[model samples]
Target chain A: MSFPGLPRMTGWRPIATILILAGAVAATARFAFGLGATTNLSDAFPWGLWIGFDFLGIGLAASGFTIVAAVNLFHAKEYEPIVRPAILTAFIGYLLVVLVLIIDLGRPDHFWHPMVMWNPKSVMCEISWCLMLYTTVLSLEFAPIILEKFNIHAPIKWIHAISLPLMIFGVLLSTLHQSSFGSLYLIVPNRLHALWYTPLLPVLFFVSCIASGISMVILESLILSRGGRDYLPTPLRANLAKIIAVTLAVYTVVRLQDLLARGALRELTTLTYYSLAFYAELLIGFVIPFALLLVERIRTSRRGLYAASLMVVVGFAFNRMNTAITGLEQYPTQTYFPSLIEVFIMLGITAVGFSAFSFIVKHFPIFEGAAVAPGLHHTAVAAQANPGFLSPDGGDLEPS
Target chain B: MSQKKAMLIDVTLCVGCNACQGACKEENQLPPSDEKYLSLTAFTALSKYNDLYIRRMCQHCDVPTCVSVCPVGALTKMEAGPVAYDGEKCIGCRYCLQACPFHVPKYEWSSTQPRIQKCKFCASRLAQGRPPACAEACPTGATKFGDRDGLLAEAAGRISAEPTKFVPRIYGRDDVGGTSMLYISPVPFEQLGFDARLGKTPLPMLTMSALSKVPNVLSVGGVMLGGIWWITNRRSEVQAFEATEKKNRPSRHEDNP
Candidate 1:
């Protein structure tokens, strides 16, 4: 029998592919004609939906790296099952961010100038250099999985040697650029509305990235399990929930402190949409998820866990957009609803992320118990029966 | 003649006529200010204080924030005290736009291949030792362009001589770590759309404070990762060793076998 998670096609493949192609075409048009030709960006709103969603969206989707590092590198044996898939998701999410950057740039050809002509004073220069370096580091971190697919063994041993340094580098690089993304707006004090403009913006951005990344890991795992993939080990899923629970609690407290420090709490008393959004971001995104994940019963139920994770992810996305767009938009009443082409382009990039992830999982030795169970069956029965639909390697044939 | 230099804008001396705006377009060979490219390079701004025409341009600061943040050195502060741009070197990252505390750098975002467009402080005119177009075209002596030291002393002398006519302070003297272009307003500087919160500190210093943490974060992160890796790898190795030793041991009843 075929694996349940494997694409059965059922005729939906053609439709998905066509939609993705349309998105790619629109994205190309956006780049060729200039941002003004497609996007609704302006001087008041220099960064529009693409930078807001694609960069911040994928950056929050960064849970894959931190989760994998937490489990595998740290030997959190309880988290092992989720590690490989998390890394795969992170790799694709990051690649999409780079793709978005290329499109967003006014002069995409000169994008490489940051590499050779480094300006130490500019945060953008630092962000540019770090992003490129970190992408390389991530690719290296994901190499063992790719190598395993081809049955390559000798170099696999060296993976351990480089893994430690790379993991450290990955975490450091992620922190700086994620924060630097906030620093990009640090100088825009007057233009950026008072609500989002604070000296603590960078710190707030970093904390939110951590909280959102953990939330994303939990969400991805829940979705994968529901899709009837090789099941996530119970222990690993629990560990992810616990991480999300703790991080959310911390994020909530920090966000409140920041608001208080900036004396923004007074503004919340006004019965405006911004005030409502502020409370909603806190309540749904952080408080609710943290409380639910803490309860053992909620964590144990598959659906409950899935719903909580999904809410947190939505909450995180809303929070980032609220700061980047909605908060700033209130100043001059400038409207910036994404055009149709812009929406399609974002959807297309996400499709690419999903497709890349699907291919990687099918080949890699991502699941731990998948290989072991079949071998045990052979020894117990003394029958030369075919291990039905087992991969050719007899073990969970690791892809490399 | 060397390109005319210096735009001495006397905010106190005249009414807000927009002759300078028209002259700047003509001098720079720029098109009329359009809605699509509503940049400060050729845009109009009605001053918040008493509706004075605040013809904004490159301030040419002593410590130019634009110069500091231009990743490719596309924007450089010349020895003659003008901040100049090299379009060929501009990658158009627009950090210079964000970094400029005075909010001077503007972009041609409407174009597919946009370049940063900002006031050059009439560097070309300065090279020719001619008065800048705006100051020259100004019908009143409200605007002047001269040597940096001369301007500062002149500003100081004016403030002392006519304290009642102008505010006690000179704008841009200490704003954003000081700029060559000085402004003497009758009203408060904040009322004129100037950012008063920008302290005596240079903008680049704030960014450097954060970037300095990079090496520290990396070194500490490296050690922590190494420690975790060692523990995980060690545990598995010990487990494997135990398994091999267990298999080699003799059983109590199978000593002869």
Candidate 2:
């Protein structure tokens, strides 16, 4: 009953299993019945929890492009240890978004409509193309890791030949869509409240995702470190913290400047539901994380880094949720909370993601840089010719 | 692309009758429901502010934001004046529902095969040389249908004819780049729940301003990345080549000895 790739049905892993089962059932009921029966979405609020989750997932998964661009494109080879995990996370993150999209779509069957039907004018169209194309590039980037396990060298070499271009294209696609998520709301300037809506939303979104993306990488390393191994060295994690701190600082400055310029500062001074939510989001997502990371002691400490990254991720979610839901709540005059079915379905998809990540990591060379294939998994001896990429930064990548 | 028809809804003349709502439901073949606000079943709904009854329907902007934001081109601005919805083409991402400034588009969330439901300006009847069903059904002539230019002029004429009786502004004349539906009210349009601050520029222009920069990003970004990759990798290649040459070169001390 055991498979090499599947997680053992023990510990908290079983909860994920149960969730996966429940989520699949809920998904079936959703498609079988309708969004109204499953979700609290109405004419007043067409997008709800799922759309917010899409932003969160995409933002957090930003590590894949950022890391690859640094190592493969800029030749920053010192940070190659977490490359496989970052790529895998991005792959899972995107697929999860697509899954939620299918469940969220009124016509799951017509999800392909965007593929054949082109509307270049629409930001959504551009986002759809980028999502698909970037996923392909990620596959190429991560293919060698799996191919080496199976001892398949030909495609690995082919993939390596075009690796630089592939990584560049992936980064470009990521930049477009990550910002386009914010652009999606630009049309709703009237509908979205003054507190959240701004002409600089795209820039804000793009910058914030970089912070969250790096935080995600840091958080992943810390979380897995509990299993008795430092997923990333302290120096490396601190280096990443420095990046997050700088990104958050830029985000804070831009946001403040924009708010001041628009004369929306008065709205913040007034006590209202929206102002409170905005305050909370800024505090959790930006202010707190920025200040915490500024402390050299906290930045280098495992506990401090953990708290900071966790705050960044939470804050990232808060900002996106507030932007997507809370800010738009006033115009609609109707409150929306996801139904039990909706909540379960979202949880299940998340569980499935975790399960899939564990499964792939167990079988593939994700965390470890080894190309070992014990027992029957080893297919051929292409070790010398295998497209194992060395440091792109040359010798400057050595433990500095 | 054709005649460019428009509807002028004079709120002052409206008598709080729900006949237009009824007529819209009947024409679209939606289930009969006297909904208080816009819904899947009611394409046109009436909201009362004291004695004034306001009609809510698709503003059908000339540069419809919904049309511009639809990834599948499901919501389209027709050749005539109506903004049409093609259900078969709809992936039902609900971008139209989210983007509409008027909040006119409603979804069939209760149906498995949900499509956006909105007022289509009775496009079929317009093809048959008739006004929209709502315009035709209005008992007090509150809703008038005609060529867009003609309606603007007539609305202008009415405002000046009895400036004291009207707000003296056509609500949709310049708002959001001129919606197909025009409005003239006794009081301020905001009092009637109209978003007067939607700006004179079309909403699509906001997104387009960002999207327009995509080409520049690609070309400039591509060249810069390629150049960096070359320079960085070339330095590494040169360093490794020099290292090998140092190892292979004959020793000067051995030659002297």
Candidate 3:
């Protein structure tokens, strides 16, 4: 049931469990009370952190699909080692989005209505169908790993046969829904502020999601390496950094071009706060990451890569919030603020997702040889003669 | 092929009283959304130019973004007119909330079972041989509903008859590829809370152009990948063939040996 690089389960379990319990309680309170009773959502702004963080945040986190597609479908095996973990993070992130959405829905019970009673005209209906299909595709794509963990090789060949097709289909579906999310906002031409309003919002959403997805995976991998003491080789980090840098560069250029083409740049000078934020998002999220990764020296350096990834991650978050909340605040008379319970529910949803991911990863053979025993470090000198390249089928678990 | 239904909202004739708002609520059987659901409330835009109480509601866009962008068919425009929503068909994803240009579609963010609600232009009433509650209840005859062409003509007639009394351009006539809900105001629409910069193009048309490029991007990406594969494989094939030919033919190495 063992794979190549699994992490040990001893430390993360208790902390994850506590967070999960707290999250569940918060979710329950949200469902019991109305949205006004829960968080800060107001009339001026209908969507808040839940829409921005859970939906847009997770969408960007799905860069795992792009990387996996490039490596597997395109035969770039250099990215092979990072593929499994990237897929795992994306799957978990999406699962968290669904949880947040359930808590956010005014009538969670009617969630299935979109499926049973289909409306051919609703954008949300399209989004729902696509999200459902995409979720299934992601799970199926990640199934091979799950099966490998279980040593249930009975259907391994069948699963492997479908992997490439599923990946192709997943990319297609993700593209549709990701862009559709922005298209949803295109309806409010008057409501959404001009500075943020562009017919190209959907395109921006699609590009940013790709850039952020890569950023998130890179960040996640570095954290795992530091905390788990796993060998996150410099070469692999360099390769990832290069991908982030290039994509971010493209994203920055396209974003500015969109603004200029729309003739909304005039508003940039008039609206100082939005203009600053617009620049901040582009500079920190895209420009900084691009600059850092462009340098061959910095790409190889762990500290530089980490800092760049962190900025991209934070910048992406701000961008999503700005688009969803601040961008739509031109009509200050109708300002929307999320209620207290809404904030708690959002926090709870995040905690639950994190806890669940930690639990599943710990119990499963996901980390494989990454999980090392405590005493193994002390015996490193003695074990030098036999470098610990764990057997493909079975090996000593390492602490990561 | 068919005539479009339209509403002509004359802001000059509108009184500051909220009779339209009350009448709309009565017809739709909707509770007061307070400030939480601005779109559903049949809002009035208050301005400094004579304090014209402009009735704000769905524009009934020619190409509804909510309909096209919706993954499911939850929001649809009927031939009879008005974009209608089926609550049972809604998955509670707020894409409609995001896509609407006029901010017409409002979400029940507080409800776990939220359905997107907006003015359906009283499609049911239209079918039952009646005008909308707001139009019927307007004491000053500020709001008029009729066939799209008729409304446009009426709007044009008013502007020409009293050139000084109305704005030259008709609001919603060409904005976002023309809306069924038309507006005639003495002051400019921008002063009356209208988005003059929406341009003449439909929102859906803008999105469709970009979406079409997706296929081109994918095909180009495919060709590039395929070309790399061909180069790599071709080089290996040539190398193997040369090695076999050398073994078959008498080589310089063989003569030396």
Listing every candidate in turn, what is its Cα RMSD in Å to the true structure after a full C-alpha superposition?
A: 7.0, 5.2, 8.4
- By summed lDDT, which 10 consecutive residues of candidate 1 chain A come out lowest? A372-381
Tens-place lDDT per residue, model 1, B161-243, is: 98988888877777777776778877777887778888877776666677777777778877877787777656655554454
Model 3 C-alpha lDDT per residue in residues A1-400, reported as the tens digit of each score: 3322333446666666665566677677777766656767644456677887665646665775676666555545455556666677777778778777766666677666667766544446666777788888778767766676688876656655565456666666777777777766665666666667777777777877887787777776776665545545688778777777777877788777877888877876754767887777777888877887899988887788889888888788877787788787754455566665566656666666666666566666555553221111112322332323322432432222
For candidate 1, give the lDDT of residue A163.
Answer: 62
| Candidate achieving higher lDDT, 2 or 3 | 2
Model 3, position A168: C-alpha lDDT score: 61
> What's the lDDT for residue B149 in model 3?
88
Which docking class does model 1 fall in?
acceptable
Q: Arrange candidates, best TM-score first.
A: 2, 1, 3
| Residue runs of model 1 more than 4 Å from their true location after superposition | A6-15, A152-161, A363-400, B1-8, B32-51, B98-101, B231-257
Compose the digit string of candidate 3's lDDT tens values, residues B1-257: 55567789887888756677777877877664333225544443223355676677777788777777665567788876788888866655566666666766776655655566778788888888788887888888888878888888899999999999988878988888878888888887887666666788877766565556556655664565456544543454455445444554465456567
DockQ, each predicted model: 0.39, 0.55, 0.26
Give the Cα error of residue A334 in candidate 2, in Å.
2.5
Whole-model Cα lDDT per candidate? 0.69, 0.85, 0.68
